[model samples]
Target: MLCVGLDPDQQKFPLSLQGQANAIFTFCRYIVDATADLVCAFKPQIAYFASARAEDQLEKLISYIHRHYPHIPVILDAKRGDIGSTASQYAIEAFERYQADAVTVNPYMGFDSMEPYLSYAGKGVIVLCRTSNPGGSDIQFLPTTDGSGEVMSVYERVAKSAATKWNTNGQMCLVVGATFPEEIAKVREIVGDMPLLIPGIGAQGGDVQATVKAGRNKNLMINSSRAILYASQGEDFAEAARKEALKTRDAINRAR
Candidate 1:
């Protein structure tokens, strides 16, 4: 259930890789090689590469994972959202240019903006439902009535829409933060058996046992980024990442 997130911040890099050429790709590939057998998926946050002007490195890293660890899916955490015309181009960027097995998207724009991505057969499209950030409640927690006159929060509406209406091709999943176990259980109840990408465990201090109990009986990709990535700032970063990932995996299993 543990999904190792590759958010390679150069400032946090080990001494050996700090000034190397192509360090982003090299660092991420090493992490992938070290933890591929320990994780169910790899989530690469796009802003980390884009801010560092290493988009090409991100592409190479994903390609390396595809060529070597093809069994593990790559979820590009772009959270892309746009109009239909522009969303089509963004789809090309994610599915064609990056060749990501799955991509995280913002569902605020509704189904039309996401249709182009869902058009790609066999590719997973994960929508942001209840985000991990504290500010998510500002919008996600607002009460709104559904078509049936039932009151629910925005996140609940998103979960309902993704499960019953928007998931025309069965390629949809929801994002519910690990911080809110009650909300996670509510989402699980709304969307039966659908996969959920649960972020906010390690650096964000979300509990593993509550998350497991809330998200039980469904597919959950519990992601841990900084805690695993910077497990040690030494030459053994990859091994350290693997160890942290293994420890995290064991914790989630024990919770299960």
Candidate 2:
């Protein structure tokens, strides 16, 4: 699926909408109007809105999108990871408070931490495996001896663990960043048919072609955030964003 990420930064808003929550809402509205037909889903990274103290407003925007655009699934990118009780609260906030179709989460805290969210079979839980950040390799690529005495990467182990042990709920998917095509391909093999939510294609300098060829599955949802959302700061920004998204979508389809 073509997933467009709406990770808005207020500082980059158009001059006419500078420093306003309404501006962010208006920008998102225009983008939804522009690219709705081209995308299967819209991902709003919770951290972006939360950082601006617009978490409540963000929820309202998400709710409005759901009510008006029921055809488009909304994925809340929160990367939430905690124990059962706290995770229950998070699940409520994601599935009830905001009424999101899915959410991105960190699996570093283990299975029980993700259980409360995964319990909802109709909803989705995307567990972070290999991130796009440059510093990610410090921990994720660490070497460890496997049953065969062959060295295995930390990310490989994480992908295998999630696909085999934790995917019992069947709501499990993985967040494999686009920056590492080889790692993504490996994860794709381990997960088999499970959906993978891929991010970091645009501003992160990830190779879109390689990412599409490597990480994709029939269930995959490739994402592009800042590259499209912040494509322009003029009146035609929405149209520019739409063009960029369409290019990415068509490119992905071509690669597939």
Candidate 3:
């Protein structure tokens, strides 16, 4: 599935949209309408909408998409992962409230913190193993001694666990950034056939060819955000976004 992250920041939004909620709605609707055929899923970053209004309104926008475009799956990129009962509430908010088909989660909080969301049968829990950020290497690449006294990177351990242990129900997936192909390949081997959510393609300078060659699996989903959504800053932005999304989607399919 090709997932497009719809994060509309005020600073990046078209100058014409200035301070209009309808503008945000219109921009997203047109992009969704244009690119829905190219992609299997749409990921709307909750922060983008929440930055404008409350979470309830953001939930409504999600509901609007699911109601109108029932065929496309909606993945909420909230990255919700917390301790204790907070995880359960987040599950409720993401699943019961927004009805997200999938959600990106942080595994740093450990397995128990993720249990609440992973318990669901049909829903997907994409754990962040290696993010698409330059600073991500700071922690993800840290070396730790295993029980056998061999040292391994933190992300390697996470990928191995997610493949062999964490995803008992087959709903768990790992987030492997496209920016780093070698790292992506390593994680792919550890995670085996598990689905991978790959971000950071256009604006982040990730090579699409290398990303697909290394990360393509039966369940891999190559994600692009700013490249598609912000393809243009004018009235024809949505059409521009569609063209870009199609290019990315076709490229991904060919590599796969």
Best by TM-score: 1
In model 3, the Cα lDDT at residue 213 comes to 77
lDDT by residue (66-101, candidate 2, tens digit) is 888898889999999999999999999999988999
Quote the positional error of residue 192 for candidate 2 in Å: 0.3
Best-fitting candidate, scored by lDDT: 1
lDDT of 1 at 223: 95
- Which lDDT tens digits does candidate 3 get at residues 27-139? 67777888878887888898887777756656766787888888887888999889959999999988998899988899998999999998777999999999999999999
Tell how far residue 178 is off in model 3, in angstroms. 0.5
The total number of steric clashes, by the backbone 3 Å criterion, in model 1 comes to 0
Overall lDDT per candidate, in order of appearance? 0.94, 0.86, 0.84
RMSD of each: 0.9, 1.5, 1.5
Residues 136-210, candidate 1: write the lDDT tens digits.
999999999858899999999999999999999899989999999999999999999999999999999999999
